[model samples]
Target: MPQTIAEKILQNHTREEVRPGRIVRCRVDMVLANDITAPLAIKSFRAMGAERVFDRDRVALVCDHFTPNKDIDSAEQVKTVRQFAEAMGVTHYYEGGNVGVEHALLPEQGIVGPGDVVVGADSHTCTYGGLGAFATGMGSTDIAAAMALGETWFKVPPSIRVELYGTPQPHVSAKDYMLRLIGEIGVAGALYKALEFGGPAVEALSVEGRMTMANMAIEAGGKVGLFAVDDKTVAYARRAGRSGNQVMAPDAGAEYERVVDIHVDDMSPQVACPHLPDNVRAVDEVAGLRIDQAVIGSCTNGRIEDMRVAAAVLKGRRVADRVRCIVLPATPSIWKQALKEGLIEIFMDAGCVVGPATCGPCLGGHMGILAGGERAIATTNRNFKGRMGSLESEVYLSNPAVAAASAVVGEIVHPSHL
Candidate 1:
């Protein structure tokens, strides 16, 4: 009857022991909805005749995806979210200057932490698992129900144990590690399952790196990607203003459906080819693949650490004459920090366009749209056809270091090659 970290958290909310595949109703610690998902959730809440959220403070409404409005339609969507947040007396609503990707923003602000069960209307909601929280995404309707009731039902997912070992080679980042795993597992390998990352290599990753890996776990069909609470998690939580949070870890005897071990020192920089996150290859194999653009920002890899990596590679260097590089900070706070640290100057001096903290090119909403047949290297998760523009265009996913170096060469190259 051993339990994984996710099971332990869910059981605490349910006040009972539970098993994978068992359906249970548990109190939701946090409920999140972004601009793209809030409107529908709001509509559903209204349809349910709910006049107020179960706990105003537990609900967060973030206007990020289309913030600063992409068009009249996007503006209208944001207005609806704004009006709903105001009427509900929701103190966690973030819009305008305070906006950021909800997954990244929530954890960075200490709204999510250890042992919490968070539900978000975003596929990347699983990102919170990096902090030892059991977070997952649900449809807007499910999010609406959670908002009204502060509870929801879940069919516990079986867990997959991922053990990591060895130190990563220089420039071999969490992003590359994730891409390699996804390639090995294929896109559907973990359908409806949890991926629990542990062991020495995971311990070596910074919180930002863990966040990047967890954020993309969904790309390989995982329900959630979790890491056991450790000093790194606690340090990050403290930095984000959290206190009195209890760390959670899987029982030593916890059963897993499968176990995969990765030796980080064996990994190289990796890239996910166009149209599929699992279509990955070593960076050296894809070197010199011409690219028209480079983007370094997303909930997955747009933290200050990512900026530092990109800055380190781009310092005193200029982007290739034919390449257009765009750098987006994940949040205004991160943007300010980068500015103070001269990372922003490094990007600017290298001819990279530094953008406001926004989803921007990640979702192809705006900023660096690709024309047909063009290719790009992006730090963002996802590389579905047309994800960054015309369906004929191609997207190759890499870590910030590789993306920055690629920008300098106008091709997919290893960061060390710069």
Candidate 2:
């Protein structure tokens, strides 16, 4: 009878009790769309004959995907979407790196909170679960309808409880532990279920680290992923302009489909090999793999805390002569924080390229392109083929610490070694 952060949020929004396999209608507090998906969502809403959005304040249009418009088609598409939002009188629209990723941008602002049923066009919308929101990704068509009706249908998802216990070794990160957990569960093991991360190991991670873990839950096929809003949540809330609020949590006897235990006392760095997320291996096994570039940024690892760790390695040291290391902040706010913390100067002194506060190489649209058959290592999510910048290029995924150490050595090396 244990509860999960996801369940608690859903229960708050529950107009009626939902049993397994039953469809439930819930009020959506916010609906989001981005460049890659916003056009379709806007079109669908207009087709539905919505004279105006259900609530202008409740709908957010972000242009993170193909941002800065890599080409004319992309630019025109954004222009059209912006015109539509303006016509609808929606003021929640965010453009350029100032907006950042939807999930990252929304939560970093006060637009999302506990017990809110937030829907987004992008699958990683689940990242908002970090704050105890009933956040889930939906198709653009569904998002459009939600924008008009302020409600959506969902089949109550089953639950998977992951209990992680123990402390992280030196230089280890939430990314490493999550990679190991997903490796054990496989990419599809948690499909259609809410993954609730818990136990001592989870508590040990900083709020930023917990966000990193929850942000990538969709990669493991989870419908949503969340962590308890404990003191760490309070800390982040204070930073985000919210001093306090009644947070949400699950009932004491809440039900779950299954529970799994993960131990991290002696765990090592974990890596996701190319082509798939579940393709995992120990970092030692893949060490010495030559890398042409090292990227550190994204919604996954682009926060100020992440920059502090990466800078600790890069400060007073130089990247490998043959490697190019790019560091991008996730948002303008994060970029400002980096400057205030002197992390930006450290990166520049280390010869790392400072990029605009954007998704950058994380989505493979631009930055850090490798030659065909060339290899690169990055702290970004997904090492899938062509995920970095080149179709024939190979990529390896690791935590920022490993990426920094590898940049210093010009090959894969655990950060603990340095």
How much is the lDDT of residue 97 in candidate 2? 47
Weakest 10 consecutive residues, lDDT, candidate 1?
243-252
What would the per-residue lDDT of candidate 1 be over residues 1-418, giving only the tens digit for each residue?
7888878888999965589998989999999999889999999999999999999999999888877788999999999998998899998999888887777899999999988899999999999989988899899999999999999998899999999889888999999889988999989988999999999889888888888999988999998999989878888899899998766678989999999988888789999997999999999999989999999998998999999999999999999999999998999899999999999999999999999778878898888899999999999999999999999999999999999999999889998887
> Would you give me the overall lDDT of model 1?
0.91
**Angstrom error at residue 71, model 2:** 1.8
Model 2 misplaced regions, further than 4 Å: 1-4
Per-residue lDDT of candidate 2, residues 44-69 (tens digit): 98899988889999999988777777
Error of 1 at 261 (Å): 0.7
Per-prediction TM-score: 0.99, 0.95
Local distance difference test values of all predictions, in order? 0.91, 0.81
lDDT of 2 at 345: 95
